[model samples]
Target chain A: MSDEAIKKENLSEEVNIREAGGGGWLYSDVVKDHFFNPRNFMRYGEEEKFEFNAMGRVGSPACGDEMVLWLKIEPETEKIKECRWRTFGCGSAIASTSVLSEMITEKDGMKIEDALKIKPQDIIARLGGLPDRKIHCSVLGDKALQAAINDYFRKTGKHERVLTAGAKVIDSVLNITDKDIEEAVLEGAKTIEDLQKKLKIGALGKDSLPAAEELLKFYLEKYFKS
Target chain B: MLPKPKKIREIYFDHAATAYTDERVVKAMLPYYSKTYGNPSSLHRAGREANAAVNDSRRKIAQILHALPENIIFVGGGTASDNLAIYGMARAHEQRGKHIITIPIEHHAILHPLEDLEKQGWKITKVKVNEEGFVSPEEIYKSIRPDTVLISVMYTNNEIGVIEPIADIGRVILKYRKEHNTPYPYFHTDACQAAGYLSLDVEKLHVDFLTLNGSKIYGPKGIGALYIRRGIKIKPMILGGGQERNLNAGTENVPGIVGLAKALEIAQNEKEKENKKMRKLSLYLWKKIQEKIQNIKLNGPEIGDDRLSSNLNITFMDIEGESLLLYLDEYGIMCSTGSACTSESLEPSHVLRALGMPYEYAHGSLRFSLGRRNTKQDVDYLMKYLPVIVEQLREMSPVRMEKQKHARYK
Candidate 1:
């Protein structure tokens, strides 16, 4: 949400803070439109209707957000034939992923590479904008799409493409692994600072920091059984 | 040819947040704002009229609370009254004692000030409430110290609506004061939520100070009163002109004061009948929701005099609260949630946490506070859609998936 959107929503008397999911003018009009009426949402018990070639799942419902994206790819054009998603999150998360789904499979379809290239900023632009706190929600949509594209590549025996793309790569200098992240978390490295202090995370590149943080959270969630 | 239909009438269940200003109250205030507008400090006829209105409101509220008119000091809403009572009393009596005692379930208005005092080298002790959301007077008594200068507890909790044993706690405070021959520890109760449904006779409750707000009782916002027992001294929070007997220093809010008095009068007059009707509606809605929905848990005490007649907080398992709130909003129903996502701080209700509720339940809790305007028909409308909303959100929950996975392993 921009300053102008905030001012506009505040100026409007009809916007109920409770009705906006307690976001209180934190969402853009576009975001609200997509959230209240999400396009290509995989409704409950309807996943069986779509024969998708790839599936991606991320986040945990216990932490109050999760997304599952299923994509059907056209083999002839190597484009996404359809994209549908199921999400359990706030309005921003729903809207970001909703627009992402629509953007990817609109008209004929977006190519696999083009869909993978779509970033959180692209989703935010399409949805007008999200609040600063809700920018994290936009990241979920892009991450899920990456996972879906990875799934598609692996399923089609395109092993080289799968390996070359956004697969979780081990940090060259820190040598951070899923197991290493789990061990650090169990050894009381629960925060990003703790990871950096104990395991020297980001010793190699800043790109590995997000991956380490993600794995740390994943393992922490598992450790706490949440 | 047929015409399209209009939308259903919206139902508001967030009365605990703030009620619609009564039309009667508004009518009474209009003259003060336009015709009788005057600074009470001015020595003109208009000023006299405004001062008379303020005095009349003070007398009206004092009579309702069974307190002397002179002891009623008007200020800005509940938060202001709370600040005046806690910060004023604590600062005034700090020389006698630097310790304060309160419950963990108190509103932030009380809790946050005590915390600030603690930072300034005051000892603060917090008594915990039980899982049923009741604070035992004995627990507060146990926490009381010789240096404890104030004990501020809310009369009725705004979120859970559990009525604390305030009079009993007051008796304990009075007994301790009498035995010690010291007025070091003064008892206060924030009765903003209780002003409508509960008796607030200061003498009967044995409280040194009591806080009441107008907005929660269909009165105008930005006006409230604190009942200060005669002969009790407290420092003023605001410093300026000698208004509000020098306790609250500002030009009087004549319109708001008049509106508050009228609103309180109407609330007191109709409290009994309103409570009876609302209690029945609340219980009916509770039973209907329980019967219609699975995995539902009530968050507050059992419905009765002990609980506010209008408050019903419940949690739905396997679903988050924000989603339920949004869905209900689309259906023209308004309510609040205890979920962290719903709050600016991203922290769930401290009252629920004090009750020892699990994180999942705390994250899923929804608060429905009924009011004088609500009816069984409105509740019927709620029930018609709530079950479906809960079911849809539950189906989308990942917790359900985890449960299925666990069952498969079994």
Candidate 2:
């Protein structure tokens, strides 16, 4: 928020702009464009060869907003590849993933470690800047990358498991439970919109992994065991 | 590079959180900050003079509330006042009963402490509010129990502009005592939001223990008065210099106390005129925004509502309040989303949520509170700048850009 945007021209007519989302000098044409209509966001189906897979998953059962990020890296070389992400966040979080994917795609064979070092400000800087309050949003982006990297190692078995199985990360990422959603939905929900609207998405199933319904059913049946 | 006008270009509308220190209050505190910089407890002449200043301020505040000078205690701020009232009274009177009743909409100043008490083995019954965020006296009456030792409610809501019926609710508690054999509930109110707008006669409101903060009422911060109503006995919350008749302890804030008194005097003096003016301005802004902006929802009561006159909460659909706040800040237009505490959370507002404001509207709501300093011109300028920013941001918004465009064309 620039100090200048809120000039009170007069009392009888203070411009009551809808208090909206994250912004700053980081809010430039690039950020706006990404936020307005993010490019390269949709997945191209399983046919697109994925080289690098980074998914940051964060959730909190209490606060009630769980966010997950899935990034598909199309590696042109041993280190470099293309990246695309699907995220569940406000416009900034989605725009962040799209912008981050775009930024990582620019460099070829880039080490994943360096890609991880990419600050949220660097991403916001790409746009123009984010507001002071929204700067926290930038941190959430970095967190998503960290979580995705951990997930990458988990799938590849390249590093020791950073997260305990089924344990929740407090702030960095939310652990979405297929079981929780299924039960909440099965309790009364009739449609996808009804399910999503009634409950927060704790987790989404990976395209390569078992379906969400299957995983939830498995958990439900296990819990229902005599 | 331009010379200043006869008046500044400052347009202040964020009075709900706190008001800028008034010039008169500043003048009243100058001597205490510099010349009279002596601890009220010291034996020296400077100290005694400082002590005199503290007593004078305390006396003035007590006069305003129609309380005895000895009964008033100067505390840190409203939060401490509320905590002391609820926790202090409950702790001493635990033998009286273990049950307590309070509304859900109280500023955490009172609610949080009660919540803490529940953890410490007290039976707590929380009353609910209606869609307007107003807690009903009927609900309070129904929720009261045999063991209930205290009943706490806020005089005015902090986030939304709903005014609680303190008098009516007080009557209910009074009725409960007359009908049943329950000792009267030590009625407490966090009046942090109502000091400048409503008429606060403790006798009429019938609050046993009331909390008020000077900072929120256009005086200095860290200074507020807690009215303990002559005979209400409670254990002290703070312990030190044993100041404030041992009800509160610490060296008296001589300067802050003086400023608080002067500020309260001015606020009480100007309440009617200022309230009337703010009533007109809030109506003006609310009407104009409804007409000019499309898909916008008003969060609190209508303009003619008996609630706080300075408050105007509006929801711009398909937008997030945080982003809109940033854009408004860019234009030097300051406002708030929810309470100051909710700024960090992605959740919109507890008050709005309690009022049944949906996610779509709550997420995009903005709080534009008016004050004595604001004039019609300031609001008019806001009307001019606000639409452009909304149009621009809405154009860039993924959720509502298309819809906003359609509405704009229509």
Candidate 3:
């Protein structure tokens, strides 16, 4: 149709623009799939896998939006391998979960602490930007992801493992030489709680724990260096 | 995708947040986006032509409200109009009295400024709403004193769909001022959520300031007008090329303004019919949700004509609002919790809490606000999915199921 004809038609009706997809802040396909057919919507584990459940089980019935995240983790890597969520939310949410699932799949073995850094904006950016109001749906994704991670660590006896990762711990409580700590880690001093107990207390000052340099270096690499 | 169960249209129940641009509003706004495109501020014929369109829209908006064209200051949307009203009042009337009184139920546009005003040393008093979500006239009267410069009570509660009596409350302030005969308490009502549900006239309502939003009335967003009664001295919130009487300074959103005016016209024109249709739907949805789903409570108003036509805020016990929403999303039913602004908060709704709703039940509330575009079929579809979805989600919730089991046994 010519411009004049389009103008005439628009004048006769409403100003409906048929723009090609991939224009907004969110990927239309990702949003569509998530909204239309949300994946991992329900938890499929036995009672043992769940660490803790803080369902958003109360509040406004008007939205009819609910999110449930059932989580499981690898004890060795402290990585989140499985997450099942049910969102009574909008398309943006469905897309957010899909994107979140993709991220989880890619980082299958990356530590949970690293996964915690993923924000709603990252999910939206994966698609594009979302409509302004739909930003909350993205935030819900972020919340579900965190809830699952928190659930995983809390369920098993590895709640203390969060500090063992790329974390900055000023160690004066327990002291070990860098080489000894490295040797122990290689020899499977796995959880830092075990490492602390194994190394024993009073062997070092708070700032004198094995290679404070490395902890600071890791922190710098992840955040401060940028 | 489950063998593609055919294509389905999403249910839109978040109209209180915004309405999809009505087809009529779109038709009205089309000229500015194309052939009739001209800067209203220009000196040339094109500019003059644009200026006429702007004036025409302004006049149409004025006609709907029975206000003078000069009173309608069109800006981006509800938020902008609100800021213009509250900020303009605070700055312009700084010397008059440094205090302002508004209700707890006011939108953030009003609440945020009142907060800002507090930082600026203005004593801001938030009037409390009762368990029924009604802000009393007595509270307004008690809050207003010698220093209370401006009194802003909304014409309606946005979240819970409670309509406030502006005339009754505004009269109290007027009576209070008759004795003092000096300090005129500027009254502003953010009627964005109530545009389609109520008849807004600055004169008959006797409000000093009133806000109209396009999106709420099915006009395009990013455009609305604030009616500041003549001789109401308020400073400009947005400063630019002296557009909007040098009060709001940005070059106007012409298409938005046009669209808004037409939307308002259509809303006013069709208010009675829309109200009847929506009241029936709201009442029906409310009844159906309760009959079909167990442990549901109607939060704002008992099912009646009193509630906002499109608002259906239902509270389901032991149900998480967001989870139910997700379950319903599978069936393509789109809705919102009360106030899209703070959906991610872990706390209960401020509006519902103020309404004396218990935190447990308040947190479980879901606002299924309806719109002009929604129909009986949509409600029927919602009715079909709601009970099943709620039951499914609740069963998945071990605690909820256990609680129900405990209750049933008891």
Candidate 4:
């Protein structure tokens, strides 16, 4: 190779994790550390070891990633005693969940309410920020945690404590609602592209198209007379 | 301190992405960069020397392809060659026709240009590939319209390594040309991935245009070649000092051309030996992978078919491809995933989708393109860790069919 080409080949091999975002930022040291050695991740055959009370799942294989979070709460203090997760996703997703698990369990434990306050941005901030395209990977774990929290509240007969406050933020990003999908399907926006053109589903929230399509399928089954 | 972790060997299995520049090719290119560096357009002795090197390299490449040296036009890379071939031919012959035909599985280099032409009042016919990743000649023949001016197909797919029936398709185009007594529709093949192993005789393939890049065949990057049949008309895309017979306008990349020629010479000379080695390694890896992993689907043409000798693409059910890629990268085994997450837009590979692969399986696909440098030990090393990684990722996957149960970490 030319000297320059050899130099480039060496440089490429040494490069740390890079943001999938086009900006070409290198992933943070913390992110790399967690990605290279994720913590509190459940492994094969270890599924029954934790004996967790509630679990939350988010994302989907069709969407290219998914995360499952298992939480154990202390009844008296209502503090999260343990948090374990398994995410089938890119490095950002795995690292975000690993960091989030450590953050929630540190200094005794985060209270259930406080844990619910954790946002996708908080996980990203702890990891020194993820690529723009990968921020949604981080969101999966938090959403799964929220679902698990809701599951916990519903099982404990504390329905009033179930927090569904972040629905609006997600809806705006997705740029479509259940009613919009129902209306579009009813109006014969049958294909994904037709629905996309009608609703502009992927204009901002590129990662949200799959979820919208899944929701559209449900709505179609419910409302489509045929 | 904890015992130092055992150092993992880095094994690259993504040659289809790009090959490592061979040292011999580099050595051949080094002197031209500085010692003999001069603009080929200059009238000085240094310029003559550089010009001579360029001519020699062109002659060498032409010799291998069984084409006249004058027909070779050197450009920047494979994309440039494709753009020049498609856009140049389409615009130059616009008066005669404004229609193009290509397969759905063509590289973006060909497809994007066709789409651009569509905006300029060109009709495009995208033929579909079969499940085995074969584009039928009959399908192309059926799609041919009187106004169709160009047909571009890739010699082999970069992702799945399935070889297209370029020769058969060429015969189809030739038949039309003879019957209609007009050269309205010209055949173009992006032979970028086929240069290392496949036959490149333009007459045998019956192609009016062919594209080959330096980067994919262990040569330096930033250089490519287009073979335009002697009588074919093409318009220049970039306007500047006339170069490459006024088709491509740029000062010759002398060193890059030298490297490309050297790379191609070595590859063609050792093609049979290297092909045998890669085929054996690829089959071994595929067999081992099948024996180890469950619910895995091999993508592309089956072994012993007319597939690239160095590629093995597989999809693991219930596991995300990118996750598995990361895990493998952790162990210093480099490969690629067809998952949408790796792409800008979160959609699976269009080639896989064209082959009628489901979205879920396409999202879980991985490509392992072996090279001559790879050994059985490298495949063994990959096999050792791959099954474990797949099993673990499956357990973590939401779409995994296994029953859900409580899992705890200590």
Candidate 5:
């Protein structure tokens, strides 16, 4: 056989094994598309070129991921004219942020309130679905968007209109809040056992057990269909 | 400017993950599967033929390691060999002590088993590694105790490809044994990665137990052997028939044994030439990457005698490793990463973390392990797309710190 034919045969054999063993492309085609051709990403050294009134950043470098978002808003209309972001995260994080940018700025712009209402589930759904371990990445985009909107509100002297994303305490004794439960759900807490393993939500006081369990179920239903 | 990037065949650069089976080894194994297929335990002509194949294979491997054939025990795979050596030796020597000395940069196959041993009342002292992922013999010597039962250190790290000072560490153990007038603490080295490139002379290394994997050396998967020193008692982990001198009990894998022996012979014979070629290619790959990509930190030892010739791990600042890996996969260039997102447990590589690498740098790490099939053309092809991919990912990344800031951590 020719060298090229032998190479093709070998390639097919390896590819077959990889696909059969679930080592092929990890994400959906949508996720791959968004990751490869991310929209509205602030190119390196081009932060100054984009006109933006408000900026927000989230995640810590120590946590292995961080995201910074830049937003240009139409003041009179209270609409986001442009959304650009940069993320130091995995493919899911990049895809989520890319799709979020498109969601907010597609067909001109989205109202600031509407953009804030776009949940992590929406971003994940638009990308087909992220891996269970990677669902936390989608939430980062949502939180960063809220952070930017709050920044816009603070800058515009609309202090009362500014919203706190996760301040409602769900477990009073442990100071664990609904946000903690929501995050646990996004991080693959499918059952109460998984939730307890992650957060130890009601370990301190029995009083918050029912509440924590209730919130866990609510977040589970909100994120996962089950 | 550049001609439209031509569609290239897949470049298998993840040899450190696993290697393609060599045709010669397969050819050697074919006859054992069909013609000489028999239970080695059975008293028949076919059984005797199968048994002879196993013995001959063991002899070939023993010759390479400069060990006796009777000392080698065939096991399932690399992890099985490690598990057997650790649990078997530890269980047998429990009366001596429960203490074990190891380094933090060992593969999960070793570390996880050690963790299990720790839960079973065994004391494990993990010696720290230097910034370049080197565990000093002095530190290991200091960690050794009267109660220390085993010293398990890998011959070469699978991730960063850092070659440990196993012989020096072995000599330290030997000196301790001599001074204490006791053979309580036995030394073991997992030479799965080193079998293809380095020496496996058990006497020169002064190791009591050495692990070798078949798949890592272009042999069949699901086959490995552990070389135990003569007269060093180790309890069998698997219990059934009287096989492998009653140290391991299972149906003998005649084909796998033959293939492993054949692959090891070929690897040993071609070791020097292949190492020279890979060393030159790896150094060239690193140089080209440095020239093309900015703010990239080379993980582990410099590409020389201290590091495996086929391995090159780099941390491209600002971009997450999983994202970079995926982009490279698009170009049909296969590699692996130590990034948290790529790992199932969502924790960054324990090996990189043990090296005191910051979380961001650890998440950005990528390992490109070259192999026999790789050439300068593969490296050139990688260079053609790697810079563009890194630039794109960096543009999308939010962490915009100067490399000098992270250099302090290094």
Candidate 6:
């Protein structure tokens, strides 16, 4: 069959490309667009070329995804003049960060405060929705943006405005923090035994055990609604 | 207004996922579906004709595998064949023993059934593979216990295409069975990936049970077979009227069976010629990719006799596999990735993990499995876009290989 005829048939039939014979297109058109031609991404070895004051990094390579956001903020209006990012992640992750960079810097750039308020849902909606399992990919951009905004606040000497999500140290002996515990809970650790298996939290003594258990309960309830 | 879709030429390189049905196989199966459509169990003339076709196909498959026709039992697919071999044998022989041995890099079809068996108080020992994804026969021999009932391994790994020493492991099992004077541990090999490329003679391999899938051999999907050595008792997983020696009881898939037989015949006849062509093309592609792309690591055994001629799995450092896969798809080049982001559980491929590959490298791996339809021109087209896509992704990636690793690539 002719290429054009096959394309026409595919479009008319509306065959879900993913279900077709040989691993056809898997993402939405918008995702394809962004993934193919990403917006506001720093070119390779050109991170220093774009003069950005504050930077935030989230996720980890061990987790199979990591993202870094570089933002140039205008001091006077607290506006993000430019937002560039790089990610070691999947197609959904690349698309999420690409769209996020546009949303933050488009239309003469959004205010840093407004950018911080943008949730993963807004990013997913803008990108025509990611797969259910890929919702976590969207969250990387939101978390990285908050981290960058916090960096900006710290840079501007607005110490009180620096909102910590879960960075505070909860266990002094193991140097385990609330953020570590929260991540453990999010990673499917329900009971204190599971958390202990992962983080070895309360290793030193029984004194910190109660506090760790309390924090684990709070995180479980916060994330799982249990 | 919607943009007009561009006419992009497609280049398929994911045959490891599944292959397109061969036209010859399709033609062979058409008559069974329409003209000779009859339940083989029926006593009528039409049913007898259908039964004859099934028997002929069974004889052809048996001749190829060097096994008797009665040893071949057809099932739904590769997974079904694997489930039958593992679950059927384990359940039937549970009174003898409850321990099983397998390599960690087995396909989920084998691993999941073993996991289910584990919940039933069965002990599963997953012998580790080396860095090149080669399972050691010595380790398999050491892992065997008096109570071990089955030892399952794949002829060739699907993800990295590393060819295990199945015949060697088979020899070890034979020695153990003779020395112990007990037919306690029966050897099984999942040869779905090896059917089209490697030898399937059951006598040479010394396997009690072997699995073959139709889809992997360019036949119809949802059809596969398990070769059970005669006199080895196995409980049936699917219960119904007597069919497939009362082991797999269901209406036979005559068309699929016919197609599978034809496909296997063609595959065996053309195996040497296709392997030579595929080896040359795979080497050409890998050499060009290595020369063009930087910071890449070959995952499996250096593409040669130790690996399938059609397989090339490479990890492009600092870039995730799924992003590269999608970018390649934009140009109508299809492939697969071992990246966690592509899977439902958000974990990298268990095969890569079993190779002692770190999470970073595992997530960056991509598999290119060539097939009968692919050619040198197709590899050229892939090369044209692959380097560009890798470079693009690397630019947008925050991770960088250490200087030592980068120097090794250089």
Looking at model 6 chain B, report the run of 10 residues with the lowest lDDT sum. B1-10
Model 2 superposed RMSD (Cα): 12.2
- Candidate number of the best DockQ: 5
* TM-score list, all predictions: 0.82, 0.71, 0.68, 0.85, 0.89, 0.89
DockQ of 2: 0.06
CAPRI class assigned to model 6: medium
lDDT of each: 0.79, 0.67, 0.66, 0.81, 0.84, 0.85
Any residue pairs clashing in model 5, and if so which?
Answer: none
| Selected candidate, larger DockQ, 1 vs 4 | 4
lDDT of 4: 0.81
Clash pairs of candidate 1?
A: A1-A130, A1-A131
Restricting to chain A, the TM-score for each candidate equals: 0.65, 0.51, 0.50, 0.65, 0.70, 0.67
Ten-residue stretch with the least lDDT total in model 1 chain B: B401-410
lDDT of 6 by residue, B276-332 (tens): 999999999999998999888899888889999999999998899888887787677
Model 3: docking quality category: incorrect
What is the CA-based DockQ of model 6? 0.50
Worst 10-residue lDDT window, candidate 1 chain A: A6-15
The order by descending TM-score is 5, 6, 4, 1, 2, 3
Candidate 6 or 5, higher TM-score: 5
Candidate 2, residue A89: Cα displacement in angstroms equals: 6.9
- DockQ of each candidate's interface versus the true one? 0.22, 0.06, 0.07, 0.37, 0.53, 0.50
lDDT assessment of candidate 6: 0.85
Better of 4 and 6 by TM-score: 6
Regions of candidate 3 where Cα sits further than 4 Å from its true position: A1-226, B1-7, B339-348, B401-410
Quantify how close model 5 is to the true structure by its C-alpha RMSD in Å.
Answer: 7.8
What order do candidates take by DockQ, descending?
5, 6, 4, 1, 3, 2
Point out where model 1 deviates above 4 Å. Answer: A1-26, A47-54, A73-79, A137-139, A149-226, B1-6, B401-410
Residue A15 alpha-carbon offset, candidate 5, angstroms: 20
Q: Worst ten-residue run, lDDT, model 4 chain B?
A: B401-410
Runs in model 2 deviating more than 4 A are A1-98, A101-226, B1-10, B339-342, B400-410
Give the Cα error of residue B367 in candidate 4, in Å.
Answer: 1.4
